[model samples]
Target: MRIAVISDIHGNVKALKAVLDDLAHQAPDAIVNLGDCVSGPLWPEETAVLLRDLGWPTVCGNHDRVVAAGNVPQDNRTDSFTEAALSAESLDWLRRLKPAIRFSDEIFLCHGTPRNDDAYLTEVIDGRGSARTADEADILHRLDGEKAGLICCGHSHLPRVTHLPASGQTVLNPGSVGLQAYSDATPTPHVMANHSPHARYALIEEIKGTWTFILRAIDYDWQSAAQTAAANSRPDWAHALATGRMQDGA
Candidate 1:
């Protein structure tokens, strides 16, 4: 079985369209979304509508939860923008999403960690916002004894595939389909950047009892997306959309 995995769209519909176009050719057996779908300065309602129509298996992301709850903090401008843009129907759809999905007996999906949508599963972010791949022990600890052969997650928005030798489980993060880079002030002050404005996703296939995967970064009209962000009064998002890098010092 082959599956396409996408995550962290963050409301950039142009990027999402580009990814859908790419997927039309790849044509995997199934598609799964790891959430963080519509929380940006761009087209939240439109993105949500498209996702709802597609009807892919989806998980609720941390931002999705924030938007669905309708109690966004004043400081969270992204979630606030999304909340204002989404209609009641869109918000309800988000509210109904689950934090995790067992796609199959061998496949498990989550937006971040299994127990925490806001936590990182495969990456560790320092207090300064720099991120590094977590060690095997750390990843296992975060897994909390999840026994699925294939574990998929997104949140860090970095494309990665890790194989845990001890448990023989593979973890895949397909990266961000929309916002490739951003700065966040959460558990710490930090930035996540891909260093290039490419829409990213992953395709994984199980064959003959082994799993193989590919991480893809597809080109799209990022300049238009950047201009949309700037028009929405988010110059930081514009910079990230255009250059896939945070402005100097962010």
Candidate 2:
């Protein structure tokens, strides 16, 4: 079976459409969305409706939870922005999303780690402004008792494929579908950037019990997305969406 995975699309419908257009060319048996679907300064309602119609198997992310609760935390206003934009139906759908999906005994899907939706499944923060891969042992420890042969997760927005030789498990992070660069101060202040305005995702193929995956970062017209962000009083989002760079003045 071949599966295409997408994640972290924090509302930019332009990016979402670009991803869907790309998927149409690389058709797979199934598509799975790892959430954070609509919670940003971009087109939250439109993106939510699009995903609702697409009907891909999905799981909730941290932002989804905040939207469901209709409460913005201290640092981010995504919850409020999304709450105002999303319709009742869209909110209900996002609220009802499952935390995880076990496609089979061997395949599993989640927003972040199985145990923590906000946890970084595969990333380690190195300092005040960067994120990197965790140590192998650390990865294994965070993964803990997860025994799925193929584990798919997101939340960090960095595309990566890791094959753990110790447990014969392969983990794939398909990357962010919409927002490419973001600065988060959740656990600490840090930034993530793909360095280009690209729509990103991945494909996983299970052939004869062997799992192989590929990450794709495809270019898209992000100027429109940036315009929306700027209109929403979020020039930081505009700069990040347009350039995928974290500059102070953007």
Candidate 3:
């Protein structure tokens, strides 16, 4: 079976469009969207409607939680005043999303950790050195311990896969389609501006007894998207989109 894993789409309709267009060639069995679908630069209403049309399996995220609460964070302001607005319907969709999903004995999905919807698994926090149990640590820790063969997730906005020799689990994070936090180059125009703005995603293929996790990055019309953000009144978010960085590194 083949599956595409995607997450952290924070609006940026152009990136999502480019990714979908590219994925058409692969024709995977199904696509799994790991929430945070519409909460950034582009129009959340448009982004949410489009993702709903895709009809992919999904999970909820922290940004979705904020949208649901209908109250933006007070101190955690990342974007300038211009770029943090969201539509009412968009917030409604986010509030209704689920947190985690399980698939078969070998596959599980979540926006963050199984324990909490808002917990993030970055290299620093969940690295091998900090992990405790085999299945309960980070993604790699859980994958190795569960021996479920494969586990996919998102939230770090960093695309990566780790193989644990101790328990034989392969953990994968497909990164963000809208905002990428960890990159080869730090985005500079916003935060990691030097980084490239290629929408990233993942393709999981189980052939025979072997499983392959493929990371993909595709080019989108980020310039136009940024321009749109500037026009819409959220220049900070728009700049982050073009630079591939988040306002608060979330």
Candidate 4:
């Protein structure tokens, strides 16, 4: 069986379409979306409509929850913009999404850690406001004793594949499809950058009880997306869209 995984769209339908085009050629048996579906300066309602039509198995991300709640703080421009742009129906769709999904006995899907949508799963924020790959002990602790052989999560927007040698379990993060780089200040001040503006996703296949996976980055018209962000008064998002880095030096 083969499954394609996408996450953290954060609007920007252009990137989503590019990923979809790539997936058409890849032709996986199933597709799953780890959310953060539409919360950015880009086309939230349009992206939400497209995702609703696709109807892929999806989980709610932190941004999804914030946008759906519509009680966004004034300082949260991303969620506030998304909340204002989304229709009532779209908000309802996000509200109905689950935080985690048991795809199968062997596969578990979640936006972040199974316990917390706002927490990082495979990475940790350091003292210098940067992200570092989490050690095995930390990763296992975050797993919280979930026994699925294959675990899939997103939130850090970094593409990674980790294997726990002791338990023979694997964790996969397909990365962000729309916005690739971002800065956060919740748990700590930190940034995540893919270092290039490319839409990302992952494909995993199970053969003879062994699971294999691939992380993909596909090129798209990021310049246009950046322009859209700038027009929406989010130069930070524009820079991330154009360069996949939070700033000039990042």
| Candidate 3 lDDT by residue in tens digits, 1-250 | 9988999887777789889998999899989988777766466767887887777887887667766665455444422211255556555666677777776688878776655555544344323222222233454443333445666777667787867665676678898898754222211121222156678899999889788888998988888877877886666656666776555543
TM-score of each: 0.98, 0.96, 0.78, 0.98
Candidate 4 per-residue lDDT, tens place, 1-250, comes to 9999999999989999999999999999999999999999999999999999999999999999988877898798999999999999999999999999999999999999999999998898989888998999999999999999999999999999999998888999999999889998869888999999999999999999898889999999999999999999999999999999998554
Provide the overall lDDT of each model, using Cα atoms, as 2-decimal numbers: 0.94, 0.87, 0.68, 0.94
Model 2: which residue pairs collide? none
TM-score of 1: 0.98
- Every model: Cα RMSD to truth: 1.0, 1.5, 5.6, 1.0
Q: Stretches of candidate 1 above 4 Å error?
A: none
lDDT of 4 at 7: 97
2 versus 3: better TM-score goes to: 2
lDDT of 3: 0.68
> What is the number of residue pairs that collide in model 1?
1
Worst 10 residues of 2 by lDDT: 70-79
Candidate 2 residue-wise lDDT at 29:
92
